[model samples]
Target: MLKIGITGGIGAGKSIVCRLFALLGVPVYDADTRAKWVMHHDKALKQELTEAFGPEAYTEAGELNRIYLASVAFHDPQKLELLNSLVHPHVGNDFTKWVEANQQAPYVLKEAALLFESGSWEQLDEIIVVAAPLDIRIKRTLQRDPHRTRHDVEAIIAKQLEEEEKIARAQHIIYNDDQQLLIPQVLQLHKLLLSKI
Candidate 1:
């Protein structure tokens, strides 16, 4: 089975494209969702997180304290790197197991926000970078996440791999700008990927 990576900047509509693929019966391993699950369920990883980020990493009920972790890590580059270092290996191992289970797929998508930054792109055969104009992206993000201000969205974008670099490294690109029809682009890309295998 081919391992494909799908990535893009914040609010670039990676999830929308992945949803289109999912409707076509493609198996998608959502790294961000799975990372949250791992941090909550993986005992060793939970212990490691507490050690690294303090007891507040988890709540009294043992749920992952997302707000605290974000506040601690998001503002500091070193803290963010440390958090990724602790979390990503566990997420990677989980992805390997997930891929094993979905081996019958023609191609599996590993959708990650930090595909390049976390160095997970090395495991994929190809990458698809979703693109949208910066203003559109920020607007979409603000709409989707009511709690986030424009500055918050921009800060997240600033931390991600540059758009030009992601495009240059990608094997495929899907333009998610509102002016274009997303369904057709996704369908065509789907057919193209299936043809390759």
Candidate 2:
């Protein structure tokens, strides 16, 4: 089984690309969603969070306190790194188990916004980067998140690896700009991956 990492900057339409892959019967593990789940259910991770961020890391009902954690970590780079350090390992372990369970799959996608930043890309067999123009990405993000301003979106884009960098490192690239038809690009990649398998 091939472990493929799908990544792009915020608003680059990575989710849309991943959904297309899922439609083709590909096993897609969304790292962000799984990270949240692991943070809530993994006992060791919960203890680490509590120790790092104090008891407010989770509520009495054993739910992660996102607001509290964000407030404590977001403003401090060191705190944010510590948080990622704690969570990434658990997510990696979870991904390993998920891959084991899907050993029959030809390829599996692990979609994450920070695949490279978290160093998870090192574990994948290949990487597919979804790319789009900055203006288009900002517009898409604003449309998807009504509460976020253009500045907020731009800030996020700034924090991510540059589009040129991601494209240079990726084994495949799917353009999501309005000018390109996404389905065909995805289909072509799907066929190519199938051939490889």
Candidate 3:
């Protein structure tokens, strides 16, 4: 089965594109969500995270204390890298196991916000980037997450790779600015991927 990595900057609509892919019968693995699962349940990962970030990594209920870690990691690049170094390996291993079990899929889509940053792109046959104008992306993020100020949303976007860099690396691009029709783009790619196999 083909393994495709789907990535985009914050509010570029990666999840929406992945949802369209899922509707077309692709097995979509959401790396961010799965990382949360692993942080809570993966023994080695939980231990490593606790060691790196201290006991505050998990609450008394044994669930990850995301608020605490986010404050520590997001403000410091080195701390973020350390966290990824520990978690990405486990997420990669988990993804491999998922592929082994879903061998019948036409193609498996791995949706990750940090596909390139985590080096997970090496695991995929192709990469798809969903693109939108920066202003639109900012607006979308603000609307979806009103709890975050525009500055907070923009800061998050600033941390992700530039759209141009991602575009250069992408094998496919989905313009999801709500200006172009997405279904046609998706249907076209469906045929293109089948030809690859």
Q: Which ranges in model 3 have alpha carbons more than 4 Å from their true place?
A: none
Of 1 and 3, the candidate ranking higher by lDDT: 1
How many Å off is the CA of 88 in candidate 3? 0.7
> Which tens-of-lDDT digit does each residue in 1-197 have in candidate 1?
89999999999999999999999999999999999999999999999999999999999999999999999999999999999999999999999999999989999999999999999999899999999989999999999999999889889999999999999999999999888999999899889989999
**Candidate 1, RMSD to the unseen true structure:** 0.8
**lDDT of all predictions, in order shown?**
0.95, 0.93, 0.93
| Prediction 3 global C-alpha lDDT | 0.93
Q: Which pairs of residues have clashing backbones in candidate 1?
A: none
Models sorted by TM-score, best on top: 3, 1, 2
Off by over 4 Å in 2: none
Task: List ranges where model 1 is wrong by over 4 Å.
Answer: none
lDDT of 3 by residue, 1-197 (tens): 89999999999899988888889888999999999998999999999999999999999999999999999999899999899899999999999999998899888999999999889999999999999999999999999998999999978987899999999999999998989998899889988998888
Per-candidate TM equals 0.98, 0.97, 0.98
Residue 190 in model 1: shift from native, Å? 1.4
lDDT of model 3 at residue 190? Answer: 81
